[model samples]
Target: MPPAATTNLGYTPPDGGWGWAVVLGAFISIGFSYAFPKSLTIYFKEIQEYFSISYSEIAWVSSVMLASMYAGGPVSSVLVNRYGSRPVVLVGGVMVSAAMVLASFGTTIMHLYLCIGVIGGLGLAFNLQPALTIIGTYFHVKRPLANGLAMTGSPVVLSTLAPLNQFLFDSFGWRGSFLLLGSIVLNCCVAGALMRPVRKTVQLKPNTEPQEIVETAIVDSRGQLSNVQTDKRKTESQAWLHKFVDVSLFRHRGFLIYLVGNVVMFFGFFAPVVFLAPYAKHQGFDEYSAAYLLSIFALVDMFIRPATGFIGNTKWIRPRIQYFFSFAVAYSGVCHLLCPLAPGYVGLVVYAVFFGLAFGMVSALLFEVLMDLVGAHRFSSAVGLVTIIECGPVLLGPPLSGALVDIFGDYKYMYYACGVFMLVPGIFFFIMHYYNYKKLDEEQRQSLAVEMKTSEEAEQLKTSSDDETDGRTH
Candidate 1:
């Protein structure tokens, strides 16, 4: 037989039931974590003018915030492993609210970076990782759909907040807007309170179940004998950090593939959205009209995210979902590459619709694909590891794209860069997934052949023993 699998404390999750409730909580947390940064772009232009900063310098506000969120992934993961999701999320909510409130009083650019970027970003990290991790614990068969539904929070919040931020900026200016945004973010705490932890009874293997024993004794590798009662407990030799972070995932082939693809993918992911508003203004659309484009993108995204999830969960799609994700990425890239062709208000509206569809498809599938590759059991550690590694790309992507804007004095080149970044990774994923699937199939067949041979051997031995016993009796 193949080597026995490692023993772990098993909790066979209920797959549904209260899982829907957890999804609701995830929606709220994830919505804020992603949308908050994007929505803050509304303040970027005014803030840039007020502080006499360049586009790239103002871009760093979101960049620093996103980087901190990604960098804090491991810490967030460790805390979730120790304390669970509710407390982490609640604390994250408080930090975000306080950060926004503090940011409103800022007199210098550094203050905004420290308050909204670092502290607020760290708070968002706490909210984000745990919410995603707990979903793995709560659902298995329905996980893709669950993830999709939860992720719709991004579009819904984005659509609402895009216009809301603009209105706040117009009515009360950026200062009052920041203060109000703080109060709005505090509702994440209320959402966290709803993420009640689920407890399931541990399952025991048949061979390891309690049984009668006689003359209980144990022998060590050194040939030393000891009373079984005293030596019954097995010791784990893994380091403390390994227990929490699961560093071995670095060696997992599928995880490595996912990680590399995601790193490249993120290098262009947020740049287009970050510049979308400014690009419109550069084209002479008024502020409300520019903000309206985001709402349009978000409205389509809101519907598509859930639909994509449902589609992904179907048997035909789930088996080949990696390819689906690859296609989504490529489609998004193609949209960006062709964006320059679109002219005037109608052209931009069409671009927003298509962009929304493509963006939503990728976002809905992102975590679902990761969980499929790494599995629910290891997903917490996997997400933590992924976020930290991906920080470099996530942090630098927008600012680098902004620099391209500064160089060309137009947004078209920035879109071109993002297109290439996304397309290359999409193609890479498709090819790698093809080979990986073939290897997995071969391994499964080999395992099945071994099981069949072992079964036949046992049957033959039993028949021979029965014949011998009959002969002896005769």
Candidate 2:
């Protein structure tokens, strides 16, 4: 294919229609990617007994899995950028299935860590980055809604997997459960197959035009067109590095703001969820009752995500989405901060309702804000870069929260810390985003002024030449 044709193939997104099918695929892949680790908690007690391990050691299984998933972001991003989402996700599905099958036969904690933690985590990384990235390719106007629907996969899968895992544990034991889970996870491959690559076309206007003009268009894939020049000085090493990671994102003001806020936000994010069941159990609830709390949270979360998405897509919110996201983060923080004050089961349930709403709203807008900041073309790289750095806090958050629990001999202090962590970042994002918005407006006005001046000069020069030609003819 010609260069123009190839460049054009990547320019425009369908924004809807079959894009909904792509959203369905993302929902499946992302659902499994996030839900699997949490669901595996049901097997931890058995695994601990079998391995004769401490709670901390057993806990490392999920921690390592999450860490590896975040750490593998760049590699997955590179693969997705190079080849596309379908193939990478298919391979990820296979890897996750294989990892689970292998874990079913493992004899040691180390074996589980290697199979379920590292390998499985990498597989999820592959599943996650592409699923998020492809949505940006398929939709723009309705993207928030698409993202909201796709993110509901987390709650839906968590709700299903939690109970399914318990039943499987009762029926078949942990080993047999792992085997069955492996089969179930292979459905990600089916979802991957559904993620049809969205091809866009950007056509270049004829060279006879005064300056190069580009337009987003649709054309036959095989059509021939002219070549566009690109920087040729970069060597093999630079090309490879740039292909996978866009290091320049470090300089991006909005992206930096988002990244810092997320790093802080994540420190509090997963820990609360991790400790929720244990906290409820500590409060003298039975295992079933404690687990039911998560169900309530997930159920509320499921409805709110789509609603948040619809609200975000509106003219009122989409333009100021960063503020909306900040509010969600702060809302979650306040809920956690007051969690300790909850009188009893009813209070916790009330807290769960608010937490679910806050969590859903944040999750729905998280990537949308990133996409808004960086645009689609750079979002893949931006996410990859973001995940790699954010992995530290994600890995440490639970342990640090656990230490607070150890110190206080209660979960309340940990909850307090998480609330602070989230709140600070929420406020930071709000203030910084306001300044960023003002700066962006100023920059746009300055650029417009420069363009107007250049156009006027060009017009005046052309008119002077026309008058001189008429005088010579006279």
Candidate 3:
């Protein structure tokens, strides 16, 4: 029989030296995983013209890629659980690099779908889940700060990649640019190498009975248990998928509230950004000015993410991050709702600034909130479940909004729809979270009462025993 496992309920974090390095590694891996897909838009227009496809048709490239990235989450989670982050991430880096290199040779749009959309996306899924998982393993006390720093990778990479992609396209065209990007993406492998396992030492009790000696095992962050157990209690636990991902989260009051609100919020979340440049052109702005709007957004977004991360990591904000996230979502909705009121270039620029801040705040908090709810051990699975469910909104969002444009011949309605979608979720989150906090407080109070009662009874018993012994001796 294996040794009994040591269950540390409230784990104190280790010291900071190597852990910060791990954060830096995560920063690189996560940045590439997220930013690579968005940057590929530089090639989209060229590909569309080459293939003689409509806007919707070309948009499928991004849609399929995003869907595949989300859909591949389970596979990545399972693999990360089975193996470890280091090897899984290394394999992911190779996969995405190979996908991009092969995609450069594609003669048809189908080839791009298979290579870039599916294979490259799977690679990103691998990079993303493991990187996020490792951060949790290494830091607990400073988790918010770690998450904030790691998430900054997105905007930072985006700011760099957008222009780099453009420069590459200008210099080498789509095919050559892909080849170059493939080489650059291989840096993920190096980042993966830095995610070494956190080694822990376990001490055994001295002079234990031989019978009490049991097999010893170690469990890692991914929930792979190593130790053996004798006389283990049998209980009905959820199945593997449910255990890892907690599909039961749907039944959880807090998770349900978050899920419903997010579903509505996402419908409008990405669409405005998708149409922002086109809307600028529709207002008779020059093409360069319209394109520069994205640059402005990206620049502001890049700075805002790290700043928000720092803010979210604060003592006041970290414990109540859900509220912060809710506010950010609502704020984003307000920005979008006010977008149509932007009568000219200056108005649009103002809108872009607010939109950038809102987007950054939400993005930084998105997965962090999920991890806070489900825990780091189950985060991979949770993300997988959330992303797959969210795939529908992500894929349908831009197109549905575009259809609204087709119908009304104006973008205001789309903006309004998005605004309401975002606003409602924020409000739902605020109310639901208030209730959740109250319930948790009540539970904590009950727990404290029970503990105090038990302690008092033990103290009284000890006093009685001492008095009885003294009287008998006298």
Best model number under lDDT: 2
Tens-digit lDDT track for model 2 on 256-360?
999989998999998888788899999998998897888788899999999999998888888778999999999999999999999889888988889999899
Instruction: Give the residue spans of candidate 1 off by over 4 A.
Output: 1-11, 45-55, 167-176, 201-237, 282-289, 458-474
Off by over 4 Å in 3: 1-10, 200-244, 460-474
Give the per-residue Cα lDDT of candidate 1 at 59: 75
| Shift of residue 275 alpha carbon in model 2, Å | 1.5
Please estimate how well model 3 matches the true structure, expressed as its whole-model Cα lDDT.
0.82
Worst 10 residues of 3 by lDDT: 1-10
How many pairs collide in each candidate, listed in order? 0, 3, 4
Top candidate, metric TM-score: 2
At residue 114, what lDDT does model 1 achieve?
98
**In candidate 2, residue 442 scores what lDDT?**
100
Models ranked on lDDT: 2, 1, 3
lDDT of 2 at 447: 90
